[model samples]
Target chain A: MSLEVKELFKKYGDKVVVDNVSFSMPGPGVYALLGTNGAGKTTSIRMILGMLEKDGGSVTWEGKPLNFDTCNIGYLAEERGLYPKYSLMDQLRYFGELRGVDRKTVDERIKYWAERLAVEEYIYQKKGKKQQSPDQLSKGNQQKIQFLIAMISDPQLLVLDEPFSGLDPVNTDLLKGLVREQIAAGKYIIMSSHQMEAVEEFCTDITILHRSKVVVSGNLNEIKKASGRVNLRLKVEHDISSFIRDAGVELITEKEYEYVLKVTGDDQANGLLKSLIAAGIPIVKFDLSELSLHEIFVNAVGDEAKEVQE
Target chain B: MNDAENIYSIRGIEKVFLFTVRQTFKNRGYLLSFILFVLVFTLMGPIQYASSQAGRGAAEKSMSKDVEISDVENVFVCDQTGILDESVSDLGSVDGNVSFVSDESVVSDSLGKNDIVIVIKTNETGFIINGIISDSSDISNDTLDVVTSELQSIFDDTRMKKSGISESDIELIYSGVSVDDPVKESDLYVNKDGGKGKENKIQSGSYGLYMLGFAMVVFIVISMSSSYIITSVTEEKQSKLVETLLVSVRPMALLMGKVVGMMSYVVLVIICGAIGSTLSSYLMERFLGIDKSNYGGSSYDFSIFTSFGIVNTLFLVLSILLAFLLFGMVSGLFGSTCNKTEDIQVATGNVMTVAMVGYFSAMVIGFMDNDTVNLLAALIPPFSFFTAPVAFLGGRISGVILAVAYVIQLVVIVIVLRVSAKVYRLLLLNGNTVPGIKSVLESVKGA
Candidate 1:
């Protein structure tokens, strides 16, 4: 099924938060939505979920308008909330009831999750009374429960906000694997995160939000190539000021000994290499680097927008 | 956490609410305190009753107001029931009071004299007698007024006769003494109409307990359900569970679930209080052996008290239920709006204030009749239930009227729930504080 968001606009009083945002994201694979803080990323996610009313716009899933029924689609809001006093099984079952899951399955799924999450010891406790609370669990464990709350519905489209947050590296890896598992099972996954490595590793398609507008989006590699950005690394015997004065290449970073240049445009890097050699700059090693998602973010939303406007 | 990637549904939100309530009750600190406190207070019932039986003040004053006959008392008495006969004479001689049921036995009613006054028995209604004035007794005019008011009550009764005299009877029934001269020199602070007697502490205790039951029911219903809401929402927000649930289920549904959960809590507390009250009252009556029927009813027959008691009990129960529903729903709506436990504290704090105001206002309204609160309370959301109970207690309203008020309040609650649910869906997850009172208007205006 296709999700289409057209000309969406949201205003907070006189301030425009989501301005004429438009997108058509067909799911079944992870879609990485990227943005800086205060970039209206959260606002747009809320609008897309139909949780917040837009000033003027439309969001349709499979050509049907969004409403309570469309709510069957799962979501993990940017700020997740679970009953602090809820136990893992109790908390999961409670949400399962609201989602209209069968009563019998709630227990089954809860058992499954408890074992899978390795939180079984925490369940079925007679500590005080009949119930357990989420607060009794650790934060990471709480996040695990929150994740299941969104995923247990087996929603056709899953929207996760900062799923990797508060996760240790190992747990993050575990969740990253889960994302692929969901995708392989033919579930659509759309995740928003500030982690560039995670996005670059898993997101097949990406959307960058800046100042309440989409600045750059689509296939990660294609977007990077279109900007003519090539990651470069170099090793030199000595610092050469004359070798640095190149027409089509710019330094990306300079360590104490070696300078790294970002070469742009076709043939620009080859000609720069020759120019550097003719200047007798001893290059020990050089290789084209892979583009990081952060560079892409800075390219699309950082100084590029300012330079273009000027 | 590999298997943690299982599916969840919005229906789980409802389960969460119920689970929270059950756990709250199961919590040892609160439940233990509540049980212990109520039990201790309940045991005090027997102690209070025993110590209060003989104390006298207003008890004596009010006692001295009802049906006192005296002196040669020439008892010209008649009774359709034939419960008393001629040997009952000191009859007219009830202590030292005499009556002339002759030409002047008649007294004026607001509707003019229709042989309304009864010295002993005149044309069926009780006593019709005029006391001859003696210049001697040192009682105040206020006492005379008290005697007149009580006599008015006795004369209106269709079947009362003088008899069954006891040694202590004379001391309690001497309100009006005949004196031609008015004592204008001394100042009287007591109500001109209410005339004071020795106030009976046990009787006052009885009234206080009745009111205590009322206030407890109201406070427990509102507060218990409200605390359920606060803790429930706070936990949800804190655990980040609300985010996903907000997507699949509407805020209104979540709100409804919470309201239902809290409603269960309120209902439980009310039932408990009712049981406690019944037990206390039963114990008090057994121990004190009070004949409070005369203190409260319009006639010695006590049929009026019985009928009024039934009506008041029914209305009290129903109004309390409706009022609790209204309060729980509104508090749930507001509680769900907060995004953090601390935020919930602030949110429910404001909600608690409203409940407290409504309850105290209701208590204050109990002492006055025909105030704006009496009229306003019949329609105001939470206050209606309370005021209706007070009115029923005063015998100021009929069951049909109370039932109508209850139905109207129920209808208002339904409307509020429906409208609140709709708006709640849109606003539940927003991190900003909604302007409290104006939110409804803003929703209606869609602004």
Candidate 2:
């Protein structure tokens, strides 16, 4: 059985947010959702999760309507909401019960999560006493609890919207590991994070939302490769405006010791290296590859905006 | 199922439920206040009861342990039938104490001197009495007439002042006659359930307690559930937990879990309060020795309410409680549409309005004692739970009707639960703070 979100669309009085989005999401794997700001990535996720009614099309489990009885899913919104007044253990246990998990198991899971997160000492602290209302926990700790809530149920589908927003690097890595643990165990996770590097490290499949539409999707490597914009970085000795004018690329980031060139779709990358070599330019080094997820997302959004203006 | 899949299944959701309960309790949430409120209320029951309890035989006791009345005296002379007494001169000759003359002419003059003068008159139509009652009287001062002799004589049945009077035809007088009640019947009978052999009286002092307890339960339950629903909803929406929660249990379950959890405290408070009140009432009656029977109970009939009848009524109320559960869940679920805590008040305010309407209806039904209120309340879900009890308490509704009303209430609960569950599922999943009633209603109607 699969989650089928078909041709889903959402609009708010002429401002279309989710545009005819469609995806047959795979079960039990990590799928990164990449997008720039205002890309409607969050909106698309809501439509797919059946939280918002799509203006068009339907979301189904296998072939039936995605009713509550048929499935168990967990979501950690971008906001990382937890009850501030509820103790960490209490909140997690409540989320567990929400999924129909029994009382004993809820307790055991609370202990496990409390211990895992290393906050077991404060498990019984009155939220008021500790001032640990959901609002009280540090961003990272709140994210930890959010993760605990979503993962506590071992949901069939786990949706994480900006899951790593307020997390520090160390905590981010910890979360990364926990997220991987869920994925490796064949637990389906559809996650969106602003941490591009983190997403690159974990995602097998990726979907890029640009202006409420799926601009680029499928395999991460493929989408990056399919961006059709090759990035070439050159270490320059002097201002290479003269050399750059001859050719090489349209997208360019010329920084000290590093000049990034997005060469168009062609085998001209090797020829550019030859031309630079012939010009006697002291190129420190060169790294050639398809566009990064960020670069691809930028280009996708740019192109979509251009299309809208046109 | 394989071990790997079930591990998350068993471990995940279960953890959430217990964690919530623990969270709720640790926060000194509903449980603490509920216990305190109940204890206070229970203690209040006695306070109120002390005022309402009837003045029993103890009221008749005229003498204190340390003192005696030297100027007054009482006698049980069976002279209503005018049997000749050999020592009439001896009664009038008591130096300090005065003797009550049974004759009207003698009684008028000696009324000032006598402590008690009970006259028994036996004519054809049962026995009657014409003895004068004075303000200066003892609680235990009753005219006694236990005649051991078999000879024919006149007797007065003074205590049954309004007996055989058409109960319906009784006038709307301000004052009610005094009657003592031995409330706890060790063995209950189904004989002429109400207004017959025994009727439970609500004493004056206890009246205040009953009213207070009722108000406290009404206001507090609404208060607890109100914030409980609004805050929990807005919190979930704010944190975006609604989506995760909706996936596993249907919005109804999450709503149920929350309100149900809070209600556990409400029930606890009520039980504790009940026990406390019982003990307090006893204490007040013992120590303060206040007689509240002066307030009311000229006419009382618990025949409309029996232990069995109460149980049946209680069964109906349980249905009402179930209805409250749904109401709370729905309120919470609906209120959560707001993305922020600020907007929660409005959503829950609407909920409060609905709850208040039900509470008022219950109070009105309690005082007015109408069948329509009972019938309508039973069908209206939340209102049914409130009004049904009032109807039963007032003895305006029968056990059969109560059962049926509650049964109807129970069905409404199921229906409300199902619908609210739907709304919960749809609305909770979205963390949109501004969706408002339009979206919620659409989801409910759309579903």
Candidate 3:
């Protein structure tokens, strides 16, 4: 089944919030929505989920309007919340029931997720001990509960906004593993986050929004391949500043014996390496790779800004 | 989306309702309030009865002291029922010449202007005690009343003792007398205008009082339930759970669930209160020896139910339900516009204002004694919910008018729900700022 979003638009008075933002998941995989702060990423997600009214848009699942009736969706919102006074178990059950999951199934899912997310202590009560409320647990644990709620119904499509914003290293790894499980299980997922490494690790396609407009969109590998392997990390025992200048490669940064340079393509990098060898510069390490997702995002935003300036 | 989708979107309301109710019962504040309400209502009747009994005893003692200081020179007791002897004359602190006469004629002939003849006679129903004074007696009416009150208190104690009955069992013995059956004043008044005289009908003054009382109760119940609705609705925004919830269920469904959920809690509390009050009343009669029969010979008329029968009562019940739903939905609408818990008081105040207008209008129009204004008030919404039931009971409006008022209220509730559903859906996601009227209106228009 395909999930398609087309010509999504939203505005408030004279301010355009999300302008013609559009993307689709043609198959089961992770599609990333990346943007700067106040970049309307959350707003676009809300419109897609039908939580907010769009000025213009259409979101469909398998050629039907995407709603609860047509699609079983799980959403972990950016502004995370659980009822502070309610029990974690009760809140999960309530959310599960709302998604039309039966009680027995919801209970089984809760038990599974609580263990997988390592939040079983907060959910299950001990002898003579009160059940834990959302407020009583740590923020990370509460987030785990929210994630558990999102997955309680075993939805076909899941949308996560800032899923790893405030997690520690351990919890982050745990969540990432569960996300991999979902991918392996062949579920359609839309993720929005500012963490470039996580996005790069999981996302096959992406749309980068800036100022409520898309600055970059398409397959991740193709976008990187188009930019070519232009990043060169070279380390030599001696200073080769003048030799790097002779090779005509743009030097980006330099430390004691290491040089980070920008090259036009693989030929330029090979030429630099040959020149360094000819100069008797002992190369301790020589690495050439394409731009990372972080660099690509920064360059895309910078280019968009330049175009707007022009 | 189509209308069918919008209408069918409330599929998950049952889950919301159950969760809300369960959580509410689990909440400490609500549970405490419920327990306190039940406790207070359960103790209400016994407390009032005990206080009134104490007050009556103190009043009797004070009046007996006043009688002791009065100028009456003689109290002649002619006991014909044989329940009292000459020692009964010493029961009061009269400080006058006390005499026991063998015949009533002897006391009548010997009675002077400063003397009162206490003659006790047996009757088919009970004993009758007469306090007779000379026609030219110089005693004031206040003095005579005090003396007679003292005598009555003394005789009551003596009669109970003579019958070997305890003070607590007096109410049971007097229960044989059918004084508690309420009788309508209209039934006793002769209809001089061939039964068509409105004046000969139930008095407007009493009806006004009844309507005022009924309106206060309805106002209280609606205000309380509406406050709960408002609080529940605002909680979603405050907790930042609206987005997650909206994905699972529609906005209308969420509002409906919370409203109905809180309402169910309120109804439970009300039922508990009723049970407590009934229990209190029963305990007051059974254990405290305090029954309505002891409150002199005055009759209370529950003529509202008796005069109208079951049909009008059902109409009244339906009107109240519709009114409650209307106000509850309005509360939800206003509450959705709020984004903070602090704004709940303001929302509650707005609801109370609407409720007060209905209550005060019913109270004011109920006393106007104008048929046109009464009929109009009984047919209009808000006011009709408060006034129509009582107006029908008072015979100020006919059953047909009451039915019309019911229909009007139902239509109003439907319209309010429609508008509220749209407003609720629009405003649930409105962030931290509380939206003003213009924004709400705009949202409604867009919806």
Candidate 4:
């Protein structure tokens, strides 16, 4: 019931592409692998899925090697691919059959997914017209077909790499909803994306890689809680720049009498708010929140870059 | 990972095979090419026969128009063979006074300047018709030739009539006469002092042509099928479907499936070709009254199945299949090196060069009439695939040598498959231009 990837490593000649990456699922949930471009996110996913040769370590499920025999797995690769000249229905059926799904079930699943993803017209041929090929469909539609192929077998473990890269907002929401459903159905999923908010919405645990090494790895909530509430948002009716200077607060940004500040803890925030009240500034808004996933990712990667520079 | 794990697996091969076959048939270009292949093979014989018949008719008409005998005043016929009658003088377009003479010497001496004497005499081989004209006669050579030709035709007709052979039976009588020096069954494959024993010179010449022809056919079949394999492999690569496919099936399985799938198409085309050729032969014989056996002036007893019997025919078929698989695998290996659709032509060219070398070498060596060279060529790969079967059927090489050639071909096929599998696995994910020999070697080493 758990997927474990331990100390996975990959190197090409003198370049270490994925170095000592490790993580585990422990249960049915979404685990996110996030990093900047060329940060080894896709590489780690490829190694875990056995698509690429690993220089070190093993990927195991339920204490055994993870493979097609041990667990039914689905992979949505970063690079979207389909037989451009082949019919979409034919490609989907072929993928389903390759994964050992029977024809009847494959057709049923295709029908279900085609309808659910709103691609039935492209997949099913009308009276005399030809079935649509991948090339004939738009790129977003082609991606939907690829996604359907990954889900046709209804695999227990699914790995999606950059699943939302080129999708428009509407299609992105559609995919996000499907991921949530899979989570609800108790399937183990690993998703990698540059869209931080999407990852934040679905992932319970995460590992952030920078320059081929993990900089942050833990449950999302625990990581956020440990960092504490350091972001302060304040909105006032009048200018409070002079009182903010007296309280010695770090001014991150200001716009139209509303202020965004950084503080060490609640004490600093309380002191700033107390001064604002005593100065008789009408408090329109005062909010304290933990760091967003985007901020956390930037800070972690930024710190790593500074260390490398030093 | 072990070598077996990395390089050998058939899991999910059937899906790959079926998909490849379905897509290939769906491709309009491939379907059109297949139809054309069958049509050409089927119509080739009939077309050639009809053209040759037309050429013969035109030649006859031209010859008749060019011949003139109006200057001759008389034609004296001496029927020395006793087969011709007084009607022999009326055999041609001669407007002269035609008369039969009793003695050839007296008639020949009495021939005037404008007269020619037609003498029909029997030799041991057959009748010999000679036109005799006086040394001072003004009769032209053309006139003499016309008279001689007319006398020969008359003599033939009269002789056939005297012998009671009907006109309809003339074709049967003049049909191809096949000569064979029968040897004991065990002596068929026995090479007596490295010499061809009891081999008819004419049959050997025909057999050489047959060998060359068969080698061309093998070259064509392998080349066409290998190109299909190359295209199929590069299609998958160019579409960037390798990663998704690798998860479902191993590299070797994918390659094996595609090769077998394309070969199945080749087999279908070959069957169609056989049907077309058979149809053409039937059409020629039934409608044109032309018999292939008699057309070339030599017996066509060179059919592999008929000449070598069933066992060797099976062996020949096996060698052909192995040869096809070997070439197909090599093509797949080259195709794996391709990263783009543009690389397909170069990959196909590399494999075709190997096939061309095999085909031409077999053709050139097959015509040499040397048993040792034929036997050696038949035991070598690439060439053996093309030459061995025909050589064995022609008795240029013994059965043992052919069997040895089969063994060598199988070994070569195994080696090629292994190498192909290794290269395919190593390079399936590589996204670069077609790799060179050094890169391939490096990849192989790493694998």
- Runs in model 4 deviating more than 4 A are A128-132, A303-310, B1-7, B58-65, B68-97, B100-143, B152-207, B294-302, B369-376, B390-408, B435-438
Native A-B contact fraction in model 1: 0.62
Judged by lDDT against the true structure, how good is candidate 2? 0.60
lDDT of 1 by residue, B321-432 (tens): 6777787777766665665566666767777888787767665655444445555665565677666665545434445656677778889888777767556654455556
* Model 2: CAPRI class: acceptable
Candidate 3: lDDT of A278? 83
- DockQ of candidate model 4: 0.50
The residue-by-residue lDDT of candidate 1 on A1-310, one tens digit each, is 8777787888866799888877677766778888777778888887777666678888887787754366457777667556554356666776677667887987787777666666666666766665446566666777777777776666788888888889888888888887878778987677888877877777788888888888887887787666664666777788754565645568777876577877764477677677778878778877765567877887778875444334
Minimum summed lDDT over a 10-residue window in model 1 chain B is located at: B1-10
Q: By summed lDDT, which 10 consecutive residues of candidate 1 chain A come out lowest?
A: A301-310
Error of 3 at B76 (Å): 8.8
Report the lDDT tens digits of candidate 3 across residue range B347-386. 7887898899998997798678688988999998788889
> Which number leads on DockQ?
4
Q: Candidate 4's residue-wise lDDT over A1-310, tens digit each?
A: 8898889888888899999999999999999998887889877887777667677888988987777767898888878788888888888999999999999999999999999899999988899887766788888888888889889999999989878878999999999888889999999999988778888999999999998999999999999999999999999988888988888888999999889998888898999888877878889999988988888888889865444334
Candidate 1 CAPRI assessment class = acceptable
Any idea what lDDT model 1 has?
A: 0.61
DockQ of each: 0.28, 0.29, 0.45, 0.50
What Cα-based lDDT does every candidate model obtain? Answer: 0.61, 0.60, 0.80, 0.80
True contacts kept of each: 0.62, 0.51, 0.64, 0.52
Between candidates 2 and 4, the lDDT winner: 4
